[model samples]
Target chain A: MKLDRRKFLNMLLGIGGIGGIVSIIYPIVSFLNPPKSAEPKVNSLKAGLNSDFPENTSKILKFGRKPVILIKTGKDQYKALSASCTHLDCIVQYKQDTKQIWCACHNGLYDLNGRNVSGPPPKPLEEYDVKLIKEEIVVTKLG
Target chain B: MKKISNKLINWIDERYDLTPVRNLLQHKKVPMHRHSVWYYMGGVTLFLFMVQLFTGILLLLYYRPGEDSAFESVRFIVTEVKFGWLIRNVHSWSANLLVFFAFIHMFSVFFSKAYEKPRELTWVTGFIILVFTLAFGFSGYLLPWNELAFFATKVGTDIVGVLPLVGEPLKVLLRGGEDVTGATLSRFFGIHVAILPAIFSFFLALHLIFIQRQGMHEPEKFKNLPEEKKKYIPFFPDFALKDLLLWVVVFNILIFLALYFPWELGNKADAFAPAPKGIRPEWYFMFMFQSLKFLPPHLWFIEGELFGVIAFGLIGLVWMLIPYIKIKNRQNWKYQPLTILGVVAVVFIFIMTILGYIL
Candidate 1:
């Protein structure tokens, strides 16, 4: 069957219009529901025993290069925050007296709870789910 | 009362003549032939300014610009205010983009003869707007009061101190003291929110007015009009709509990049931590910052800093004066080698900016 010039042109326009719409709409929808960044809740994996963490201090424990700020708040209770600033990913340090995470790059100060206090930082440090399993500390990266 | 209404209507009708403004602005019709995407740099700059203004007001709702309240206020916004973090990011990024596009727009206009005859005032006002924009960046950069802000301001303002004779006074004027502390933050905040915006709006209105009065500069071929030809179109339904559409596209693109990549802010500045190894100025200043590297300690006994400053001032002066620089038929810049220099200059700036970041 021979396609007429008008029909061919209509077909071309229709294809082009659909392509344009998809190109614009798909990215927007993908942006709105971006791929999940955090690990799914799972059996908490242990980092090390209580003796490894000293009193009134935190250490950056590496779980597959996903750095966790493990703070031994009390003898039994431990608090954890991501070791990076949410603003730009500069390493954050644990503040002992105030019980906050501090970043040196921008003077970004974060409380133990991972809340941003000051500077050009836009977001708070991410907190991790720190569960004491048996005698070991298991810190899972939290969203 | 009836006579008064008639007289008022007549007065309003006479002064508010839409035709002349529309005739001159004629917007899209005026430009006639802007084939490249780069031609929209000015419009893009305008678009980012709108973004900055909108998001800035949103930030102002929670931001308290002072020593004691500043840090806490930012904390409150991040955790307490709904979607405040997102708004702040958009505002900061948009401010940077505004400066970026303004530079591109200014240079493009220079090489294209867009700042030519009857448009010199437009050029001057545009230059002033650029200055106000730098002021906006300087002021806004200090508002958060973190360590980076503290040290960056200290180093940045100290550079001003290297000037001969006026250096000390200028630094004091900027910081309100020997160091950049609370006073400097407050002053910068005031300028960012109030004075700079007011001045920018004044110049922006004038710039738009002149752009309207002169329309767009044509390539040499189209400078002369044929007898009785009226090819110009209305700005509102036609060009303004197109501008708005393109603006929406740019906004969406910027927001997407901001969210997905999420430009990193440095860790909270630790006033105690040694300054970051290689703190540098924002992208727009990298050229001048890098330019300083090439200069000698002193230009024939003149302080290097002073001579460097004067030298840049001269470059800017030349840039602004380009439209007045006469050339043969000069209309077709597409083939001109001098135009090639403008492109090279822009590329060099980009390379230096990236190098500054990497180094």
Candidate 2:
């Protein structure tokens, strides 16, 4: 094929235009994605002392941007799970009467094991690891 | 210098045909009439919006959006940064003036019946732009995180919550959660800086393209005149120079207002504090805000606020579709219904706005 002067110039212009567009878009796309500093990777948070959370009671504490419910099932036994309901993101509460997690927004229910058992919740609640370190209850998010 | 410029122009003209562009610039004409003054309104609005874009970006350099830092960052800008106060004030004043001139441009088009027939899409696009401009004001208001802005946003979103089925979810989505918090500020910041500007630029481009394609809307009286009797000036230099002169005047006014009465940061928002007395939305929104205030708590079977919202939505829909509305005119009729409706709308808005400030 013959590469005429006009055709060569046109190809160059097209390549230059694409290069210009990419250069403009690269920074914008990168800037829009929040930097690592803005969203700290908080894997573990010291919730509170075990005594403050009595047995059969649950307390919602801020785990980064999300709320984690820490429930004391029994003496020296604790369970931690994400408080955001799978249905609509309303903070789920521990229903002592039913011994289950309940979303008040839509009556979505989850068992003590964080399994979605009933209502509109399509998935189970995420469970976290609970450890007692020097009388402080620490909740660590599991992968 | 002239020879160099001419040579450069010829160099580009050789590579690409510039006839269409040259013809568009040199041959385009703007109608001359008493109402020609209104033509400058749109240009002034566009210029002010450019000012907003420039100043908004400058302020963004120092403005951080978060519950803890939003107010403090703004305070730092005005107090510490060099000429930051001037940039902030220009942004605020120019935003208000942009909305004000947009309203004038819209009303001028309406009174002149320029929205009829071929220019319907132009009107629609222009209407959408006005709506987006108001949304810009509403979203940008909360970025400062001041007491007035926070409370105003709360009230604004609460009004959105009063709608029927979608209201609750929409309000939640807008607030990012149940109530106004740091999350809400982040959402508004993204919307004000990114999403709205993207969509607004698309519609603005379409609006300007349509106007360029069809040229300016000549008044009916001017259109009816003989071709020799009608007067027009070339848009390239004559009309454009006048537009530039008006922009300079408007810019001076904006600077005067910004310098004389600089925008205040007010107190940092305390969510728990009882909202301060006389919490009001911005002046552009006062008409609807005050009208909603005058509504009774309940109107018969339905809630008054809900009724007002629905009524406003329907009225806005009708106004947007006015160009498509066909009203047969009986000969010898005293007044046009649409014209009367426009006048009534103007008067009602003016009265409600005044009452908003006073009562």
Candidate 3:
């Protein structure tokens, strides 16, 4: 191929422009992808003393950006699950009457084991491991 | 002083070959007609955006973004910093006015049929800019980290999650996780100040270049008039001065609003708290929010909110491509289909917006 001075310069400018644009875009794309810290690695949180948590009662505790529900199903038996509804991120409340998690925003229901039972929730609420260590209740996120 | 200024201009003109620019400014003309007032709408919007940039920067000097400090910083800004309340108020008021003027500018363009043929790209670019302006408002609304803003953001992002495939991921990306948190606040802060401004400026530059190249759109009546009968004024001194006068008038109104109705920094956001009653989106988004609220839970096979969203998307796509949609005047009707459609849209928006507030 016969390459003229104008054509060569044009090719160089085109490559230079592409290179410049890529250089600017690469950092931005990576920067916008949230860092690991953005989703805090909060694996376990103390949910107060097990003695204080009465039987058949639940309390919502802060777990990073989400809320985790700790339910005292029976004496020395506890369950922990994500409080955010899978449907729309509305915080779910533990219903003592139905013995299930309920989202008031859409009336979605989840079983005590975090299974989606009814009403628009496409997925189940996330389950967390509950442990009692030295009389203190601890909620650890499940993988 | 005039002699020195003329010499400086001549020196630069000789080196840079500024004749094209000089001719552009000197020879450009604005067509004068009944709809000439609408021409000032875009300029007013631009002026208000400038005000937003100014006051936003001033607020940023004291504003901090975090779950812990966002509300506190805003409180400090209004209560501690000198004239901070005024700056914050001006910023909030100017942001609303900018959106208001942009809507007027868009409607004026539509009714005047200014988006026809060669100006199609202008209309498209303007539409994109308006979208980004709303994004600006949405992102900025969360920066205060108040209860209203917190729940509003949640509800807004929830609506985004209602879409099918891309919706969930987009919602996660916007929120920076599974939920709206300090991470979301930081993300919105970056978007409101840096990302949005950079993108908005690029489109704005293109929009302005297109307008400058095309001059102002002449109404059909003005276009049909004979050259001898048609009226026009020089764009540089005559029309430009009028635009500046309007900007001055608008600036006074902005000051009046800021002084009389200061923007409030409500209660701080509490993640565990149940969403407060009567949670609503901003005024510009109220029409859509209200319409979505009116939808039944299930519309046929699809969820009602999802259906509403999809409908809005399709309608917006058609509206953006209005100039390209060719409809044959089969009946030779006096009123064009597009014009009638525009009127219907205006009426719908007005009624929906009012209902959004009152109901």
Regions more than 4 Å wrong, model 1: A1-143, B1-28, B34-39, B224-233, B263-265, B268-272, B294-300, B325-341
DockQ for each numbered candidate: 0.02, 0.03, 0.20
Better of 1 and 3 by TM-score: 3
Best by DockQ: 3
Q: How many clashing residue pairs appear in each of the predictions shown? A: 12, 0, 0
Error of 2 at A98 (Å): 46
Q: What does candidate 2's lDDT look like per residue over A1-143, in tens digits?
A: 36688899999999999999999999986655433335457899998787777789888877876778888999979899988765444567888888998865345689999998976565799999999998899999998
Candidate 1 vs candidate 2: the lDDT winner is 2
lDDT of 1 at B323: 60
Tens-digit lDDT track for model 1 on B1-359?
99999798678768886565545544445445443345578888998998899999888988998788787787777668888777877887888888988988888776776677878889988988898898788778878777666666765676677667888777777776555557777778877899889989999999878876666666554556573553554556776777788899889978876676554445554433434545656667777766654555446777555677777778777765666666664666656665776888788888877766665
Best by TM-score: 3
- When summed lDDT is taken over every stretch of 10 residues in candidate 1 chain A, the lowest stretch is A32-41
On the 0 to 100 scale, the lDDT of residue B64 in model 3 is: 91
The lDDT of model 2 is 0.87
Worst lDDT run of 10 residues, candidate 3 chain B, spans: B272-281
TM-score of chain A of each: 0.64, 0.74, 0.75
Ranking under TM-score, best-scoring first? 3, 2, 1
Candidate 2 pairs with clashing backbones: none
After TM-score superposition, the amount by which residue B314's alpha carbon in candidate 3 deviates from its true location, in angstroms, is: 1.9
User: Per-residue lDDT of A1-143 in model 1, one digit per residue for the tens?
Assistant: 35698899999999999999999999875543323335434534577898877878877766543556788888888887767555334456777887767765445677767777765345666677987778888887665
